[model samples]
Target chain A: MTHEAGIPLGIRFKLLSDTPQDSAAQVVNEVVIGDYRDLDTLREFARGCDVITFDHEHVPTEHLRALEADGIPVRPGPDALVHAQDKGVMRARLDAIGVPCPRHRIVTDPQDVVRFAAEGDGFPVVLKTVRGGYDGKGVWVVESAEEAADPFRAGVPVLAEEKVDYVRELAANVVRSPHGQAVAYPVVESRQVNGVCDTVIAPAPGLDETLALQAEEMALRIAKELGVVGHLAVELFQTRDGRILVNELAMRPHNSGHWTQDGAITSQFANHVRAVLDLPLGDPRPRAEWTVMVNVLGGDYPDMYSAYLHCMARDPQLKIHMYGKDVKPGRKVGHVNTYGDDLDDVLERARHAAGYLRGTITE
Target chain B: MTHEAGIPLGIRFKLLSDTPQDSAAQVVNEVVIGDYRDLDTLREFARGCDVITFDHEHVPTEHLRALEADGIPVRPGPDALVHAQDKGVMRARLDAIGVPCPRHRIVTDPQDVVRFAAEGDGFPVVLKTVRGGYDGKGVWVVESAEEAADPFRAGVPVLAEEKVDYVRELAANVVRSPHGQAVAYPVVESRQVNGVCDTVIAPAPGLDETLALQAEEMALRIAKELGVVGHLAVELFQTRDGRILVNELAMRPHNSGHWTQDGAITSQFANHVRAVLDLPLGDPRPRAEWTVMVNVLGGDYPDMYSAYLHCMARDPQLKIHMYGKDVKPGRKVGHVNTYGDDLDDVLERARHAAGYLRGTITE
Candidate 1:
C-alpha cells in the first residue's frame, strides 16, 4: 500500500527494512515520507516531485484528491484510480463506457445470486470479492446452489460473471504521461493458474494481427478515457471466436511487464518513472523481435536456489530476477526473462528455468 | 588495492558503507578488508575471501607471492599479472611468446635515452615510466635530446619505443578462468586525447574482418601464453597499410570493455567475477551489431547534477554510470554507453552525451 505514493523519479526504490536483502530492489536516493492515510501529510510529501506516480494503487482516494486540490500532480487521478481500487467501481465504469465485459450480475446476498444464476449462465461462474483480491486470493468459483450461499455470510462485495471459454488470455499494456502521449508494448498472451499468471509471451505468437491491434488500441483507449497518467495494464480473454473481452484493469506496473526490464529498449519501470513524472515517453519497442517472461511461483518447490543456479549455468542469456523474499507456498517470488531471434530456443530455456524455479522441476 | 581480494555476492550484502555501495557491481555479500600498502594485511584479506580479483593492477608482486605461499588464489597469478604490473616483464614475455610488440629499449640512466632515440626510429620515439603510471601521467614524448633527459632525472624507469604512424588505435580483450575456459569480447577501437582514452567503439568501426579476427586472436594467444585467469585487454593499432600492432595490456577490466556493461549479453564485470570464482564463462557475445562507450570526464562547470540531467533528458537509451566521485576539472566521474544497428546513431549520441558531461556542450 505504501507503494502508491512512491517517488515518480528514480529507479529501484524500496522501503527500508531490517533485511534490505529480502526486500525489493531498492532504487537509490528516492524521497518517500509521510503517512498514506493522512492527506495533508501525503500532500507535503508529493510537492515538488516532477511527476506523481504509484507502484501499486492503494492510496486513499481522498489523499489523491487532496494532492490535486493543492495543485500537486497525481496520475490516473482519483476518478480513474478509484476503478482499480474498487471492483464495483471498475465493473460499473466499464459498463458505462461501453467496453465489452463478461456477462455478469453483482449480488449483495445469496438470494440475489440465486436469482441471477437462474436467469443467467447456470454453472461455474467466477465469484470475486470487490477488493483486496490478488494472485488467486479473495476469488472463487461456484457451480451449484449450495456453493454460492456460503461466502455471502461474511459480508463481502461479490460479483458473478459468465465464465466464457477463453481460448487464451492476453495482457495489453500502455504507458501514458500527463502530456497525453502514450505508447503500447506488444500485447502478450498470459497463461494463468487459479487466476494467477504464470507465463507471458510477447506478440502472443500466431495471434491475429487485427486482434492484437484491437487489444492495444483498447488498452490505449482505456488509459485515455480513465485519465490514467502512468502505465495501464488491461487483462483480457480471447474467446473461441477471437473477440477480446475485458477481464480486469491494473493501473500500475503489472506482472506481465516484468520482461520489459531487460527485453525492451526501455524498461517499463524506467518508463513508468518517466510517465508519472511527466517526462517524454521513451521508445517502447522491443530490443529483440521476441521476449518471453515467466513468473517464479513458490507453489511447487521448497528450495528455488538450486533451480536458480541450474538456470544460470544453463542459459547465459536468461535474465533472472528473484525478489528478496521468504518463499512460501503459492507466493510470487521472482521471474526469469529471455529475448532473441529464436523464440523457441529462448522460450524453451526460459520456460524450463521458470518451471524449475516454481517447483515444477521434471525429467 | 584490496579489490584484488574478491567481491561479496549480492546487492543486498550490506557493504558496511554509509550508502551501502560496493566497489564491484557483481560481488555483494562477503566482507572484504585490506589496506592498500600493508603487504601482510593484504595477504590475510586475500586468504580469507571466496575468490581473488582486482579493480586495477597495482598490487606488488612480492605481496602476491606471499599470498600464493599462503594458498590464496591470485587470478592471473603473479607470473602472468607481472606482465601488466611491470613493463620490463611485459616486453620480455610478449617477445618470448612471439607476439608483435613495439621495438623497445629499456633504460635506467639518461644516457640510454639519447642512444635509443638515434639508434631506433629517430627523434620522436615514446618514453614510458616502467611502473605506476596511468592516464598519461607516466608517459611522455621525447622528440629530441633535450626532452628525453627529464624522464631519467625523475628516477622513473624509462623505456623508449619507435613511434609509428598509426591509422587507428584498438583493443582486443580476452577473459579466462582458472578452469582453462576463456571468452573474448569483440575487439574495439579507442579514441584518446593526450594518451587518455576518451571513447571506445566495439567492433572497431570500418575494421576489416581479418583485422578484427587478428585482434581477437592476438589477445587470446597472449592470455593463454601468460596464463591470464581473468580479463586481458590488449590495446592495439591498425597501421595505414594493413597490419595490427600491440599497444598495451590491461590485466583488469579495461576501459574498452566497459561497453559490455550494456552492449553485451554478459558484462565484463560479471564475467570477471565468474572467472575469478572459477564459475562458468558467460556468453561474451555482443547484443547488437554495434556498441559504443564514452567516458564522462569531470566538467569545468560547477553543477554535475544539471549536466547529468541534460544528458539523460536528451538520450534515454544512453546508460550512465557515475562513480560517486565529486566532479573536478577533467576527472573521470562516470561514463555513458550506447548500442544500436546504425553506427552513426550510437556514436553521435554517445559522443554528444560524453561532451555534455565533460562540460564542452558542443553543437
Candidate 2:
C-alpha cells in the first residue's frame, strides 16, 4: 500500500524482503532478499536510499542505531521505534507522560502474573510478551495462574495487565514529519474478531465530538513525545465507563487506518510517505459522511480474484485492496472499503464485499 | 498510474519497455526491454501473459491480431484500437456511424490539402498524419499550400480537418468491459496551450445540462461502436454555437481524465484495469462538486521534488501525481489534482501546484 502511495509522489522503493514471494516483494520493482537482523545487510540496503522506513517494526533496534551512526536517516529512529518493539517500554513511557493506560506491571513468572492481576482486577488478566508479538500472537488472556504459564514458557519477559471492561476498540491515526508538522485523522472504531482487526468505521459513529478531539490530541501528543516520524497509530479502548485508555501503539501504518485509502482525502499510507520524506502533510479529512472497512481474511477458497466480478457488480463503489499474497486460511489477504452518507449501507456493502471475496458469502 | 491502480487489485504487471529507464518501467516489477514494434519481441513478451494491454496505441494493428491468434486476449483489440491509431480511419468510421465530427478528408499532397480546405471552412485547416502522434506532435495548422508541404514531408496520409471555431475543447471519458458493461464520466473541459493540454475542469462548468448528457452519451456510443474494451476518451470541440463535434479518440487512459485520480469515486486508471480484466466496472461519479487538473510541464528546472514542501503546505488538499521521468522542456512530468465545492478555489489550487512543480511559480 505504501508502494502504491509512493508512486504518485515519484518515490521509488527498494525493499528488503525475507522472501521473493512476500506480499510487498511481489510488487516492488527493486527488492533485496536479506535478514534485517544483520547489521551488514542493513548497511548495504541503506547505502543509496534517501531515507529508510518500515511497514513492520520488527527490525532490531541496535541495527537501526548502527545505521543512524553511519549517517543514514531512519524514520521512527531507534529511540521512538523501541517503544513499539517493547510493550514494557511503551507502558512505562505512556505512564511517564500521564497518558491513560490499563494497569500493567512486568511479571517474572506465573506467581508474579497472579500478583499483578490481583493488584487490579483478579482472575482475568492479559499477559503479553514485551517484544515481537502481533495479531494475537504472543499474547494471552488468562482466567487464572494455571492458564498464565503459557506466556512465560517462551522465556520472554511478560507484561501482565488488567484487561479493561471496554465497550469497543478505537484507533487514533496520526502522521508526523521530522520538521514536527503533524496531522490527525478522525478517531475510528476498529472491531476485532479472533484478535484480528475485522472492521473500522471512520469518525467512530456517534462518538462524542469532544472525545474524538481528545483522542486526536492524545495521539498527536504521543507522536511528538516519542520523536516519531511517519505514522503513529494509537490503539485505544473506550471503556464501559465512557473513558478511553491507550491499548497499544504502532509506529507504522496500522490496519485500523486502512479505510483512509478510499475514505479520506489523503490516505494514511500517502501521509506516511510524506511524513517520512519530511514533506508537508496532506489533509486528513474524510471524503464521505460515513466510511466502513472490512478485512477479507483468507478462507478455504484461495481464489479471491474470481469473486471480484460478483462483489463489484453488487456494489460499484466498493474499494478492494489485496495484498498480492497466496490465500491461506485465517491469513489477511485483502480488505474492502465502502463509503456513503448512510453508515448502515456503507457497513453492509463493505462487509458483503469482504465476505464475498473471502468466499464466505456465496451470494 | 495504471500500475499503481493495479497494485490493490493484486494484478502483477509484465511491462514491455523500449528501455529499462522508461517511466512505467521504473515502477513495474517485471519489465522486458525490447522494441514493441518487433513482432518477435512482442511474441516473446506475450509468452506467459494471460492478457495483452497497452498504455499507448502505437503497437502495429497486425501485431495485435497475431497475438489474438496466439490465444492472447488483447484488450481494445486491433479492430477497436485502429481508430485511435489512425486519424483518417477514425474520421471515416465516426462519420459512417452518424457521429458529429469536423469535415475531413485524406489529402494526398499540398494541392489536395488546399482542395480539402476549400471543401470546408477554407485555409487554416488542421492537418494531421494518419498515424503516430501525441502531445501536439504530427499535427499542423496550415494557412496555405506553401505551409501545407510540411505535413506531406512525413510520407504518411495527412487528415485535413476543418478547424472548428469552438468555444472550448471538452473530453468525455468512458470505460467498457469485454462483457459490454460501460460507464461514462461527466464531460470535462480541457484547456490547451500551444496544442498541449494545460488544464481540465470536470463536468465542464456551466455547461448546458442537456449538452453535457449528450456529450457523455456520445462518448459512450463511440466506445461501444468502436468496441473499445478499456478507457476511451472522446475529445470534442464545443462549437461557438453550442454543438459538440468529435475531435479525437484515445483508447487508453488520457491526460484529460487525470482529475479523476483524486476527485472521482473510482479513477479512470482503476476502471481501465477492471475493464481490461473483464471485471465489473466501477462507478464514474465525482466525489467533489468541482475538480481541476493542471499538467506540470517540465521547464528549465529539473528538480520538482524540492517544491513539494511549499506546494503541500500551501494546499493540504492538493494531490500531486508525478511520473518517474527525467525532466525535459515542455514535457509532461507530473500533474496536480485539486477538488472542492468551489470551482474557482479548486482551479487556483491545481494551477498553483502545477506551476510550482514546473518551477514556473516561485511562491
Candidate 3:
C-alpha cells in the first residue's frame, strides 16, 4: 500500500492469476483468472495494461519477449529478467562480468558433483537446481556423493559449488530506471532461520564504512551491466576474511528491503513504481539511526487483530504491515518495523511484536 | 491510502454517494448511488456496513441518531459531531466547558449584531450563519449594519463574535478511541489565503513550549468533554498577548494534519482508522525537526504528471500527494510536503514544489 492518497486513481492494478483467491486480487482494481502458461491469456492481460511487471520470476521469458514484440512496455525486458528466472544463466552472467561469486560449475552427472567436491574440500558441497527453486527448496547441502544424487533425480542440471565460510548475509537493494538513473540503499544484514528470512537490520550494525561503500558500488555496477530497470536486490555473503561474494539476485522487491518501508525517506515500493514509469528517483536516506524488521510467520495464533492491543500498547512506535492471507503453519503473513536511535531497543521491540503476532510469546 | 497492506481484505469499503463518478466510488469495493437525505436509502446502505462514518458533516444529525438507536456504530456520534456541524452549538458548548473563545452571541436580528459589536470594540464584528458554511462561505466581517444584511438573506440564525486581534492561527490534532485512549500531535500553524488553508508548519515554529502543551491539553479536554471518537482537530487563535482562543473544531481528519503523512511516525490517517476501530493508538512523534506542507491549488496547468519530471528531479526529497480531482481554477487538487533539519530550507522546498505543480513557478 502507498502512503499518498488518491494514488489509486493513477494506479490501475490488474492482477492475473489462476484463482480469484490470490491475496493480490483483493486490493487490485481488476483480476484476470487464467493460466500464465497460456500465451493467449497472457496476451489478453497485457492488452489492458500499459506495462507488465511481475511479483515472481517464474513466468516464461519467451512470453515476455512476445509482449515486448507487440509494442507493450515490459520492464526489465526478457533479456534482463532471464538471469533472475534461471539460476544457471545468472551465475554465468555474473562470472562473465567478473562479479565476485563462489567457485562453481554446472554438473550434468552425480559423478561430476563428486569430482568438483573433491577438487575443493572433500564432502559437504552445495548443490542447487538450475531453475524453479525458492525459499531453500531445490537446494541441498550434501555431505557425501551418495546424498548428492537427490538433486540429479529431478532431471534438471545441477549447480555444485564450495560452501563459502561466511559470517552473515547482506543485501544491497538498488533501483534503476530505463533512463540509466540508479540509487542504492544502505546495505542491510539479513538473518535466516531454517532457510527463511527472519530479521533484517538496516546499515548492518558495525559494518566498516569502506566495505559498505564497496557493496553498494558492486550492486550498482550489476544493475547497470544487467540492464535491469526496476528494483534489483543483490544478496551477498560477507566472508570471515572480509571479502564479499554474490549469492543471488532478484529483479523485484525482495523481503530484505521491507525495513525501508518505515525506516527510509522513500520506500522501495514507491521507487519501484517511479522507476517503472521512468520518473526521477527519490532519496533513499534513512529516517533514523537504526531500524529492525522481523517477519511474522503464521503459527498458533490465527487472529492477528486480537493481538493488536497488546502489541500497540507495548510498543506504540512499531509499524506493522500485514499481507492478507489465511494463517497457516510456517507461512509468512506479515512483518513489523521498529526504528529508533537505539539498535538494541529497536531489535527487541520488533522481535517482541512479531513474536506476539505469531503466538510464539504469550506474555 | 493506508500504509499497511491487506487492510482492504478485512475492511471492505462501500461508498454511499449520489453519483458513480465520485472519485471515492472508483476505489471502493462497492458503491450505492443514493441520496443521503433519503431515510430508506440510508437504511439500505447501513445494512451492509459494519459502522457508519462520514467525509462531510452535512448529513442530518437525527438520521445518525436513528441509526445509532438501531445498534449501528456511528463514530463521533451525533452528539459530538453536531459541534462541528453547527456554529451555534459549538460556541455554547465551548463556553459551558469554560474553553477560552471570542466574545460571542447568537443574534435573531441585525440590531442584535450591532449591539454586540458596539459592546465590543465596535464595528467590523465577524458575522456567521449558525449552520452550513465552509471555505469562507456564509462568513463575513461586517463593518456596519448594512453589511450585516447579507447573513439575514439566508434566513438562518446569525452568530456574532468579536474579531480578536491575533498573531496567527494554529491547529491541534488529536485522535481518541472509544476505549478512552487518546494521542495528540504537535500543534501546527495553518496559513490561510483567501479564507482557504494554504500551508501548515508542524510544531508551529517558534511556539513557546508551555503554550504548545496548553494547546494540546485544551484539545484533549475538549475531546473528552464532547465524548468524541475518531480524529479531532481543534482550531485556535493565538492572541497577540500570548493566549489561545478557540476558533472552530473539526471531527475528522483536517487539512492541517496533512503534513503528518510524511513528517510523523504515525500519520493522522492511520491513527484515525485505529481510533474508529477502537484499537490502540499509535505514536504521534515527529519524524523530522521541521515539516512544511503546502496545498497545490488548481491554477494555469491541467497536466500535473508533466511537472513531475521537473519537481522530482529538482527536489528528490519532496513528497507529493494528489487528490485525483480534475484541475479547476482555485480548487485544491493536491499538496506537497517537504521536511528536514533547517526550517527555512524545508519551507522553500515545499513552496517551490507546490508552486511548480500549480505552474506558478518556472524555476
For TM-score, the strongest prediction is 2
lDDT of 3 by residue, B274-332 (tens): 78878788899899999999998998778878776798889888888766678887998
**Candidate 2 to native Cα RMSD, angstroms:** 1.1
Off by over 4 Å in 2: none
The per-candidate count of clashes, in order, stands at 12, 0, 0
Summarize candidate 2's per-residue lDDT along B106-167 as a digit string, tens digits.
Answer: 88999998898878778889999999998889999989999998988888889998889999
Q: What is each candidate's fraction of native interface contacts (fnat)?
A: 0.10, 0.93, 0.40
TM-score of chain A of 3: 0.96
- Cand. 2 Cα-lDDT: 0.92
Instruction: Grade the docking of candidate 3.
Output: acceptable
Candidate DockQ scores, in order:
0.21, 0.89, 0.46
lDDT of 2 by residue, A1-363 (tens): 999999998999999999999988988899999999898998999999999999999999999999999999999899999999999999999999999999999999998888887787597999999998999998899988899889888888899888899999999999999999999999999999999999999989889998899999999999999999999999999999989999999999899999999999999999999999999999999999999999999989877767877888988988989888889999999999999999999999999888888888888
Error of 1 at A317 (Å): 3.1
Q: Which stretches of candidate 1 lie over 4 Å from their true place?
A: A1-14, A17-82, A104-106, A149-156, A298-309, A324-330, A356-363, B1-49, B59-80, B149-156, B304-326, B356-363
C-alpha lDDT values of all predictions: 0.74, 0.92, 0.85
Candidate of highest lDDT: 2
lDDT of 1 by residue, B145-263 (tens): 77777777667578788786789899998889887888989888899987778999988888889888888999989998899998889989788778888878888888889888778
Model 2 chain A: worst 10 consecutive residues (lDDT sum): A301-310
